[model samples]
Target chain A: MRLLYQILWKDHSRVHLLGAFLGTLAGFVLLLAGIQFYMDLKAVLSENRDLLDPEYIVINKKVNIGNTLGLTGGGFSEEEIAEIKAQPFADQVAAFNSNKFPVQAYTEGEQVPNFITDLFFEAIPDEFIDVKSEDWKWDPEKGTIPVIIPQDYLNLYNFGFAPSQGLPQIPKGVLSMINFKLRLQGQGRGNYDDYNGRIVGFSNRVSSILVPLDFLEWANEKYGYFEKNDPSQIILVSKDPTDPSIIRFLEERNYDTIREKLKSSRMNIILKFVLSFLVLVAAIIIGLAFLVFLLSLQLMISRSSEKIRRLNKLGFHYREISRPYILLLFLLMAGITGLSLLLTSILAGQLHQTAEAWSLDISSSLHGVIYGTALGLILLITASNVAAILISTKKLCK
Target chain B: MLEQDTSGSEVWEAESLLLEQGKPYVVEAPSGRGKTSLLSVIYGIRTDYQGLVYLDDRDLSSFSSKEWSKIRKNKLSFIFQGLELFDELTAMENIQLKNRITAYHSDERIMEMARLLGIDPFLQRKAGILSFGQQQRVAIIRALCQPFNFLLADECFSHMDRENSLTAYKLIREECEAREAGLILTSLNETGLPNIDHSLKL
Candidate 1:
């Protein structure tokens, strides 16, 4: 213990302390921040699962030169659908049913009458539809059709179309209160009818306008003049949205998917990659910092080599002389680890505040993964240095 | 047994040596005759030799490092020729260091010994700052601070004057007599001490 006091009171390598503190702090921050980003991203994605279901994906054919020049059909064929169904990743597949008849939609009961515009109506199986409001269903007996539109459409209307047309911007709740009229016509069959269409909800998942399958079937049966038409868009229920195989498969087939959900999935992959890369970099920097620590210790030991030899001549054992060095290293390592954890907590709290400003809920607690990794690094580094000091002191004793 | 130099040249040879308990032996040799090397071998500090050494019945070569440390701490004590003191420590600390381990003498006893050796005035001074004779007396005092069955002195009095040398020898002889320990003193020539029970010239 007296030896320990002497070693601690005398040994001060400022360069080593500065190097270790700054290097390890930087490495630890990068490691913790990367881990924090990954955790927050996962949390946000999980919370928004209703908006972007990992089990569902929007698939379309590649719009290439062959497709534009009419060399190949720009849609899924029966064989193509069968091929998709055979894949292990595709748990279920559903096609968007299109109304073969022409559609004319216009808003009614509004202060400023909206212009009548031609529109396309698509439908999917009720089981595949995410919206669960009572108004989302169709009753052909009542001549009322339920429709779901993209949320982006409302944003465009309120922010772009309404101002340009000198119409008051309408909020979503008020817009849902207003009724609309839809006109269906079969050109060659000379059949026409008007029905009441009501907006049930907005969809962030599916961008295209949606109506009930029952209404689409009845309308097409009564007014559609063409033969059964192939669907251009298909909804695929992938087993795992985060699977690299799914992305690779889509890329290999020269197919495209929904931009928003695909972006989310791609961001997840990129975050994982960045996390691993940052951890690797941190590991390398930590190794260097530990090396600097060891070099400093070696310098101190070599400086005291003469004293050690003298003490050995006086019948001092190696363990007794080297204990002080090992203790100092252990205390230093523990201090750095503790400071890093504190800094991480403070930084994580600031990140949480930033996320809250963006209307995202994120936790500021240290993630178990980051904690475990830091602890492992501290233990590994300290143990290695202790062993090295012991060995060197033994040589000195000899 | 022959003690060889770094070039493997024989420097000193002894056919037989026996040290009886409670007896003093003076080993005399000229300079560069491995006088210090002989003391080092007996103290278990050097093993690079061409012959076997035995402490009683056990061969010195078979002793592990721990065993050697035990012998140094409990049984054998040596005052090196160069007086390998910790320069960073004080003269008082140098004595206290060994005394702390051996606990053979109290602080008052150590101070009394320091006073008799003429080192009590520089007790708090760093060993590096003291004169050669002062440091030699400090080393002598440190060596005597420990309990031992054998005390090896390698020219410990070379830097001291005759009067101081006699005083150191008197104190060492009295301590050895009290402990029933054997004293091995290496010197360039005999001093004709009547108390010496044996003498070996290498």
Candidate 2:
């Protein structure tokens, strides 16, 4: 490093200082950007890291129960369920069902959705509400648990039952939206004539619709028309996706794979793209900076040609004369790289700390520092060439 | 035929001539006569020309560029016609730079030469800040530290007064003899260089 400094700066002290400062600054900018981009990706990744884990099997099949169609479809068989339970990777299978929590409440003066006639909300089952439980201890007296949902669901769904047009309005907690299609022949919004509505639970964008056993049973009988009860979706949780043995074990079985909720290898590709883009941007910034730095170096070299020639006259070799310059540029890069790392590290670190202090609920990430340093080094190496050695043939002749 | 040992030639030809070891060889030549080129050739900087140039009984062409540098850097020194001092460094720093390139430690040789060449007073000042004469004096000090066997002086004494030039010449000759090294000095006018035993006229 010292040798590099000598070569690059031996003849011109100011240039050495200036070039190094600029290089380090460039490095810093590159590093900061790289780290930032990495953190952002990491947040995205860490959130889904569990999803990418080898153990989780996301049962994703789209069941669109829109304005008219009622989803009365049944789920997996008893034998199939038993087979999944037998798999070693299957820790605990929680049966979670997903249907869009219908915002079919009476918007004043508008016809409500027909699917709301027998509002068959795919409520979270007793199994799903007690999903975290090891044994799913049931309270016989309480008769299954109601689900917990975010508060935002109430704003989107309002069951308007004004008494002016209604017979007798049942208050909240008395009725639940069960599976019954509305035969709304009139255009103006009207209160429910058949179904009883109750907010058993609500849902955020994430899945959180739960109906206790009694409610589910009542709704199933009223809406599904199924004599025997059957689930809609069975959630499969795997043990290890990273483990090839487990993956093979699962694949060998007849367990149909659901790649929808499961994060795929495409996540890895996205991460690579983000990192590569940051590096490319950094390289461009640094390349331009180095070009400017190299210009100064050329002038210095042009001037030193005579001194070099004279030194040669005294028995100095071309290599010896060029050594100091080479050494200088090396040190220059090291110094700049060091400085850049320091500067960017502090800024990025502080930002990271601030993020932590503020308790931002961002997820963990997809990429790291390896990508950042790789980029900086490539740029510095290319730039040093411009600064290294360029002796005019005319100077040689002199 | 044995060449005539001129005192110190201010001019020289660009010919492959045998130079005696441990002798004060003066280069007398016009500006474009390639005195610096010959000097550079010996220094291993001029690589394109084809000829036999020997150093310490080894053919210059036989050694690799790296090997040549090792040999020359340790055993050589130059006095640029323009003095070629680093403008950023102080006068003393400029003189010591040659020594630095040669891996010599301390400013002892540089300071000693500075004292002898009458540039010691301006040693602390930068080369660009120094007068032309003062810069020349610093250049002489640098060459003195080079103690080079084959000093290729390219009119380093051009700006110096006759008295200083003579002193510079005397100092150079004394240093060359002490080191038992060769010298190939160039000048347009032969007013200063002294104690030369051989001359090459271009």
Top TM-score prediction, candidate number: 1
| Candidate 1 residue-wise lDDT, A1-398, digit = tens | 47434633365577786787678777777777778778887878667565345567878887889878988787888887888778777888888899887899987665656868898999988767777788877777788888899898999999999899998888888878778889898775546788888888898768789998987888888888766777888888864665556776778887788766666567777877887898899888877887888888888888778777777778878887787788778788877888888888888899899999998988888889878978888888888888998888889874
lDDT against true structure, model 1: 0.80
Give the top-scoring candidate (DockQ). Answer: 1
RMSD values for the candidates in order, in angstroms, are 5.2, 11.8
Give the runs in model 2 whose Cα sits over 4 Å from its true position. Answer: A1-234, A238-398, B1-17, B24-40, B47-50, B80-82, B86-91, B100-138, B153-169, B183-202
Clash counts per candidate, in order, are: 0, 52
Query: lDDT tens digits, residues B75-159, model 1?
Result: 7888988898877679988887888878889999889999998889999998999999999999999999888888999998898
Q: What class would a CAPRI assessor give candidate 2's docking?
A: incorrect
The top-ranked prediction according to lDDT is 1
Candidate 2 recovers what fraction of true contacts? Answer: 0.38
Residue B161, model 2, lDDT: 81
Give per-model TM-scores: 0.79, 0.53
Q: Write the per-residue lDDT of candidate 2 for residues B88-147, one digit (tens) a residue.
A: 667876665566666553567666767777777888887889888888887777666643
